[model samples]
Target: MALVACLAVALPAHAVNQDDLLPAEKAFAAQVSRSGDKLQLTLDVAPGYYLYRDRIAISTTPADLAGKPVLPAAQEKADPYFGKQFIYHGKQSIVIPLAAGAPADFQLNVRLQGCAEAGVCYPPYTHKLKVSAAGGKTESKLDNWLGGAATAGKSPAGNSELAAKGWLTTLGTFLLAGLGMAFTACMYPLLPIVSSLIAGQGATLTRGRGFLLSLLYVQGLALTYTAVGVVAGLTGSLLTVWLQQPAVVLTASALMVVFALSMFDLFTIQLPNALQSRLAESSNQLSGGKALTVFLMGAMSALIVGPCVAPPLALALGYIGSTGDALLGGAALYAMALGLGLPLILIGTFGGHVLPRAGNWMKVVKSGFGVVMLGLAIWMATPFLPASLVMLLWAALLIGAAVFLGAFDTLSTASKPGARLGKALGLLLFLLGGAQLVGLLSGADNPRYPLKLIAASSAEGAASHPFQPISSIAELDAKLAEAKSAGKPLLLDFYADWCVACKEMESEVFPQPLVAAKMGQFVLLRADVTANSDAHQALLKRFGLFGPPGIILFGADGKEAQRVVGFTPAAAFASQLGQVAH
Candidate 1:
């Protein structure tokens, strides 16, 4: 009896509960309905469960009765089991195209696999439905419990399915993209503003108070962003275009200049005495109004500070404008803002403890922030500034920063360790500044690199492959006709100045000798969507492309051979070209 009791105590807690695991039917319920010669399969997924978008398969009994199933856009998730994949939670819908003169009845088979949030994955499940058609009306043999039947000549499932697919995908993409944008040059300036707000909480600052202030600030940003996106969607105008106007750019640059001056202690902008007294009183009483200042600042930052355009932002705006669905658009924008604020929140919470409280070092940190603000101001004015002038401004900034870092100062034996570190950084900056000055003199337009020497060396040997720019569907069709007449394959590249991936391809991938050599075989054409005009949008729509950095290849027979989306490395792209050539 003692041994039995000991064994019982030592044994694992309890046998896995089979009943707790969700059955295939309970986890995912499928419904088949038909509308206007198209069959729609809608899946009502249970909460805490998801189905892989790519794992879904649909076929017909007669084989030729239906074409392949067209899956709706699905939310992207970084799954532990499957790396990066698209999945659908809540509900999803897929449309299958039917062939002409279809039989009155056919068997539709669907095979799918899914998993519960509890980490239990179910095996592939297949469901067969007898689909009957008569007088443009259709019904499934399965019971209506799974939404299998639809009212004749009417679709019970309206645009909700389409909205679901778009919203889910948009939310996922914007959230991830925003996180990446948080670390970019456009968003970096806001970090100092957040840090300063937390630092202003004084010596008694606590983590809880810091978090509250940060949350309020982020909420304000998110709300403003959502509002702007919705308004843009309703108006059918791209806010980024207006924001990037020369006048607006100059005004924003001037505002940043003022902020930078304030940080440098050149002057201070303070509220009136009465307003200060009220704020002090509110802070003393621990009123919510104490955080309102930061909130307003966050809103201003969202609207005026960073107006940079990106592919995700453009895609979202375009979708919202086309669909006029403010709810989903707002949700996507809100998620993006949350992602953008994540880094700021982390910095605000932990920086209070890590950063030096009050010292000479604090002044240095403020001055450093001032320099960054100045750089940001210059960057905002780039559109208005001449290319040469921009390079000169960059050179001046780098050289001035180098001088501040003790590049010109002689370090004595008694110099602090910081002085040594500063000198090293200064030397590096000085070299970079020198390189920029040289590039500026040589009229090299690339601000990121001093490429004049390299360009001159490679000019003779470099392949001279030029791309004919096309902005509209008409132009693209004409170009395709010309290519076909010439008996040459064609490569269409979608590019945008605001797209980082496009720039990466231009600078890193396209410049490769192997890639350039292979490109000589095709007629290269480019559609620059930087303007995002009606024609540009039409071109993108014609190609079924969401945004720039998309490439399409057409064979000599005038048929689209392959399409490439997003960024591809040089080696991979070269291999793809080789295969296409063969």
Candidate 2:
């Protein structure tokens, strides 16, 4: 009876262990198919397993049989073994470019690694595939499998269909993004520019002339945006970053201040008398000269006045970089610019009829614009100032504006509705300004909210896992080694004072309790690239990154697990952390 009980327990334990083990081939199945000059590698991963995107390597037996593969963007994951990484689950397909005059048959080698959901990791597995290519003149089996031929002189019907769909999607996304950006603070200054242009045309301006001038102005803006976007996309350098430098910001702010003073009638900005005479003579005959000037102003507005980076611009640039399709990218940018200029067009065409003409009301409107310009100037200079100083400046501006609006003035019962409204707005501003001043006095950095709302413990927790500063690649490598030795993950953040997205991340994402807790499990490091030193440039180049607002996570094994290129929301970021830390 004792022997029977022992055998019963032993047999069940052995069976359970056997069922837990899965064959490598069953876990990850890879296949190769050729279509014209392109080779498609497909992997069907089992439900419980996922393959690493960066860990997958391909090589031909003849070595020169094929060029490097063009990989699609993979889904981002935070891996337990690797910090942050790109991975593929279920069905994954990768396209490889074949060389000309390649053999009809070649031995293709695929090496890959993956992990099971149950915390089981497999060693790197190698699969040898016998790949047969179809003739250059004929479509291969992959033609049906891949559903397209990417080679030259082939049926581009599939390619065209795909391109058309992609273009429409990109165009729609950019259009919406452009419309949203039109109302942003960076675009406010351009409103006065458009209003001034239209209002300056005098009472003799006709609707037909107004429409023509507006169209011309918008065309100039769109063309400049398209051209700059194409160049920036091709070069993979965003001009917004360079324009955000402290020196550049200060110069731009000073120029805006001067413009604001001019708006307040402190002084007039005029061309030399001889130049004005020549311009007047040119405009008298060929209206094209005036249009040309308007066009130049539009171009300058795009390049200098409102150089804010939006999601649509980043999306278009990313697509251009990946596909090297400048034509499509340029068209997308043009569409977006037209959308952004749509309001300007409307204002230029109809503003003359709507705005009060050559009266005290006009002066009041101009003064309001001057106040707006001053606000923009302060906004531009905020990055260079301490957070506390920025908050105080904002408070001062609001309080001063309230005083100008007669917030403290007593209103009679017989006062006009407009006067009452003005006093009411002024009071609201005064209250908000008072709140901000109190927050600043209480050591709050954020100008948007008061400090007393946050508990002391939460405030302490917010600063607990602050990022360790790193400046050089050597320092990064050393940190990675330390993290590996300690069996912990590493999170490297690329930051810059001028990077708007970076500031957003710091303010909105990193301070979240979930993000902070997840960060505590990793060796937190930050590389401030605001200086753009050679070391900073090298660090960016090493990761193939163009600018800041990039986050890279490395696993306990010292391998990069995930990479996030731009600003990610807190919820999505927390999801990423869940994958690796949990």
The ten-residue window of minimal lDDT in model 1 covers 1-10
What are the lDDT figures for the candidates, one per model? 0.65, 0.63
Alpha-carbon TM-score of each model against the true structure: 0.40, 0.38
- lDDT score, candidate 2, position 471: 99
- Alpha-carbon runs more than 4 Å astray in model 1: 1-245, 271-357, 449-453, 456-460, 464-508, 518-567, 579-582
* Tens-digit per-residue lDDT, 355-431, candidate 1: 33446565675576578667767765665677677778888888989998999899999999999999999889888
Q: Per-residue lDDT tens digits of candidate 2, residues 64-104?
A: 78788865544334221122354555666678888898888
Instruction: Specify the highest-TM-score model's number.
Output: 1
